[model samples]
Target: MTAVTAPEPAEQAKEGEGSLRSSAMRGGIYLVVRQGLNVFLKLIGVMLITRVLGPTEYGAYVAAFNVYLYSTLIGQAGVGVYLLRHPGEVPDLAVRTCYALLALLGIGLMLGLEASRGLLTGWTGVPGYGPVMAVMALALPFKLITIPPTIALERALNYKRVATIEIGGDTAYYFVAVPLALTGTGAMSLAVSLVLRELLFFVLAHYYVGHGPRFGFDGRTAKSVIRYAGTFSFANWVWQARMLVNPLIVGPVAGQHAVGIVGMTVGILEMLSIIKTIAWRLSVSVLGRVQSDFEKIRRAVTEGMELQIIAVGSLLLGFAWFGGIAVPLVFGARWAPVMQLYPYVALAYLAIAAFNIHSAVMSVIDRNTDLGLCYVVHILLLGLGTWLGVRHFGMIGYGFGEMLALLAYGLVHWALARRIGSPDYRLAGLWFVAAALGLFWRQLGWWTIPLPFLALATPASVRRIRRILEQIRKPRRAEARA
Candidate 1:
């Protein structure tokens, strides 16, 4: 479970040339497809739930689910990140030991959550949330059990298999939740589906991995994983804390109906975040494969960021232009409040995309402490901002508060990257331009039709895009040869 030092730069480049290209192309396609299917299934769930329950009820369910999400994060204890970041060959004992620890954490998390039932109910302003959270807590141990196999598959770049398992779990969510909702389970449908989803994933992952858990401990391996986990898990907790700003802070202050609006907006915003998620995952995988080769990490980080900027920017732009019209049409008039709040939510995604590569680079270089420190600051700033926003400005203020936090988050990375002399000014500049164009398109409406033509008209922009296309095509060519 310890890190292995990479070969020298020249040797790395020689070995990496074709490997990186194929990995990027094949892995990128499968991951994108995986995310695409995930989003589609998620939309189906959302559509069913929204149609079945009114916003207030849906918000109540979301609040309970949020508590479950937070619990899962604590239960996970960064085991997945720890496994993914391991530089050496992962031993079976290491995996088993991690599972043992995760299972214990899961049980502890469930108990802690159950004990806090009164606080959770008060925070979400829904007494039903207490029992709903209790139901959702049942899934944690199953979720924890799946992590070892899941991370093993991902680290080996078996994303297609991993994606299959994930999609299968999501498919189960729809099948289980929708029928229950029709039967008038109310918020219970969501909680039940959440547990079923994890159980399915656990069974599928172990089946594919051809392994079962072993109850053994390896002290050395435990120390190694725990050493990394300490920082990574704390950062994740802070992140979950940041996530709770809406449900924990804003929900009680603004009321359940307001929480419903915020929940739907955040959900839609997360769907849009798939693009950034894909980019971040692929970059980490790519960097992890090369280990410590700084130059290749730089190239991968740069090319990856540029491509993400274009794709994420364009997607956000489309959402900003079309969401106002589409939200009402798709989710029904009941969800109209999402449209007004979504544009700002989209900005947070944009800022995340802007600085995501910095995170990959940080991981590659072992700057996790720095990254953790940034997360700490982000939580403090965002927590205060969200409270003020919801208390005074209402639902839209939640988006504004997050937007402000993400801006600060991006700035921390920018300054860090600058100090390391790794900031990509040109790519970073494009993010702002893209954001402005998206905002303008939303503001000016149809008049921005010619904007795409004008932006891509630049020779440099066109060439960069062409290079990205070539990078995408290289893996297909490699596959054809095989």
Candidate 2:
């Protein structure tokens, strides 16, 4: 019998690298497909729910929901990110410590929300806000507990399973909320639907993870996890404060109706920017695997910038072009403010899309302090601008505030460039300018309509498109040869 030879370490590493890239590509495609379905479901659901609830009721829901959302951040504590980006196999002790930390924080947040419900209601001044908040707060622990198992899957690049669990939970929410909203349940319909979604997620996440709660305390493990978690969470907290600005600042200054308008506009933009979400999640996994290679990370960011702007810019332009006619016709004139707010928010999201990979890279390389500083400048600019603008401009002020905050992205660029070299922003910049002009066409007029198309038809853009196609095909060609 001939003796079998084992593969060398270098060969083994090469195979492992190939497997990771293959898994990331497959996961990315699954997530894209999943988001496409989610977009459809959410579009239908938002149309129905917004029509039924209108601005006043929806505004109330938005306010309470924002409060609940901000509270959940406290419970998250960045444990999932730590787990996902851990260099190699995470220790069981670390996982258990994560579980214990999450549980304690989850319970603490739930109780805190319960205790502050009345105060929150009084502050927002939305009728029945306390009750709605009370209901939403119950989901905090369930939401937090689901993170560990969810991270377990993410670490393995099992996005197919993750997508299924998420879609199921989302479907449950719409099915539960739409009927209830049509029956005049008002804001409570959403609150109830949210609770159900979290419960379903908790169940499904654990089931697929194939494990029960395992809690333990290792002093060293706990210390390491908490050390990372603290920095990550603090940066996240500052970043998430942007969401709270709507409820805390706009709601108080311009009434809940304005809050509803801003909220709806933001929700729609988020739906359209679905690719950013998918890319960011995938980047944490993909980049972590290659974190030691600064050149690879830099290339990823450059390519990501070009591709993201192309993907999201078209959607934003389309919406900016047709949303005015569509919104009033489909959802009624009460939502007309959405069009006024759309361009500003769309511009912010566009800029974010181009630079989002920078943030992901920073996180992967453990540059939380730089990220935190960037976030601080962003939120400060946003908060101060919104407070001033809303006090002066009323409903449109939030949009103005978002525009002003776009300046802070310079900080992100600077911080990221300091670490991994600057990404090539030429293609992304061209697309951004083109999309910006198109988005503001209401002000710039019909002459600007052809500018975006012309930009894309340029020689550079055409070559870049061809290059991207080749990159996509190269993998398949390699697989075929193998």
Off by over 4 Å in 1: 1-15, 418-420, 440-453
What lDDT is reached at residue 25 by model 2? 87
Per-residue CA lDDT of candidate 2, range 122-230, in tens?
7876776788888998999999989988888887678899999999999999999999999999999999999999999999988887776677778897788778877
Backbone N/Cα/C clashes per model: 0, 0
In model 1, what is the error at residue 461, expressed in angstroms? 1.2
Minimum summed lDDT over a 10-residue window in model 1 is located at 1-10
Supply the TM-score for candidate 1: 0.92
Q: In candidate 1, what are the lDDT values of residues 338-377, reduced to their tens digit? A: 8777777777777677677777677656667677778777
Task: Give the C-alpha lDDT of model 1.
Answer: 0.75
- Highest TM-score against the true fold, candidate: 2
Error of 2 at 354 (Å): 1.0
What does the lDDT read for residue 403 in candidate 2?
90
lDDT of each: 0.75, 0.87
Residue 394 in candidate 2 has what lDDT?
A: 94
